[model samples]
Target: MLTIGKLGQAAGVKVPTIRYYEQIGLLPEAERSAGNQRLYSRKALDRLTFVRHARELGFTLDAIRDLLSLSDHPDQPCAAADAIAKAQLAEIEKRLARLASLKVELKRMVAQCAGGSIADCRVIEVLGNHSLCAAEHGPRESEGDS
Candidate 1:
């Protein structure tokens, strides 16, 4: 059995994140050592690795939880998993669209700058007046990404 620290090291996740996963039920409650430190098995290490990979792929905790549940029941059909992946793909596409729009607006903001005083700065001018922006992105910065 590996200690929590070792497990975290092997899984490329922080110790606190591992603890948080445990607290959130993404990871199983770890067994304790003689001094009450958390001890983990190889299975725990593998699970942590899976979680880290999913997180790197931008899977939310709830999605990861569902994927884990599906993992636990291997006999279940893969429709749910495929649906989750499709949803994630759709989210990614939305983010890409938002990013592309942001890029255009930013480019316009930069290109319009004549390098004069702040009062005449195109960057500040566009920023102060959202109406000047070409993209119709919403007020919140996290609208489409979420």
Candidate 2:
């Protein structure tokens, strides 16, 4: 059995993140030691590793939960998993396109600059007036609040 700290170290996840996973049901509740400290099994280690990898791949918590459910039932078809991955890929592609548009808009703003004062700055003017933009380069619905 591994203590919570050891499990976190071996999994390359922080102690609080491990606890958060447990709280959110991504990780199963750990066994308790005689002293009331959290103890983990090898299965917990493996599950934490899987969660870490899924997070690294940008899978949302909800998607990870679904994937975990799918993993628990290996006999089931992988279509759901495949669909989740496909949706993630589509989201990435959409973000890439938006980034490309933002890049073009920035380039246009920069190229039009005459190195004048702020009052005559094309970049500032374009920023101040969204209508002057050549394309709709706005933040994604999930972004901007942060």
Candidate 3:
């Protein structure tokens, strides 16, 4: 068995994040040692490693939870897992499209400036002028920000 810190270190997550995961039911509550410190089994460490890897792949915590549930029931069909991946892909595509639009607007803003001071900076001017901002983006299109 390992302490919370040790498990976090092994899983490449911070100790607080581990505690938060436990609090949120993503991780199971650990048993206590003689000193009343949280102790984790090898199973807990492996679960945390899986969670970290899934997070690295950009899976949301909700999705990870679903995946974990599916993992617990190996007899279930994989279609739900495929659907989750598809949804993630769709979200990524939307974000990429928004980013491309933002890039164009930012380039335009920069092009308006010719190494001038903040008072004459076109970037600032455009940002300050909400009217100049395109409606295709902004909060409407970008549910997620880069």
Top lDDT model: 1
Tens digits of per-residue lDDT for model 1, 1-146: 99878888999999999999999888989999889999998888888899999999899999999999999999999999999989998988888888899899999999999999999999999999978989998666566443
lDDT of each: 0.90, 0.89, 0.86
Candidate 3, residues 39-140, lDDT tens digits: the string is 999989888999999898778999999988888888989999889889988888878787898788888877778997999888888889978765457567
Which TM-score value belongs to model 3? 0.85
**Candidate 2 lDDT score relative to the true structure:** 0.89
RMSD of each: 2.0, 2.3, 2.3
What lDDT would candidate 1 get against the real structure? 0.90
What candidate 3 gets wrong by more than 4 Å, as runs, is 117-119, 130-135, 138-146
Which residue pairs collide in model 3, if any?
none
- For lDDT, candidate 1 versus 3, the one ahead is 1
How accurate locally is residue 100 in candidate 2, as Cα lDDT from 0 to 100? 85
Tell me which residue pairs clash in candidate 1.
none
TM-score of each: 0.91, 0.86, 0.85
- lDDT by residue (12-86, candidate 2, tens digit) is 999999999989888888889889999999988998888898888888999999999999999999999999999
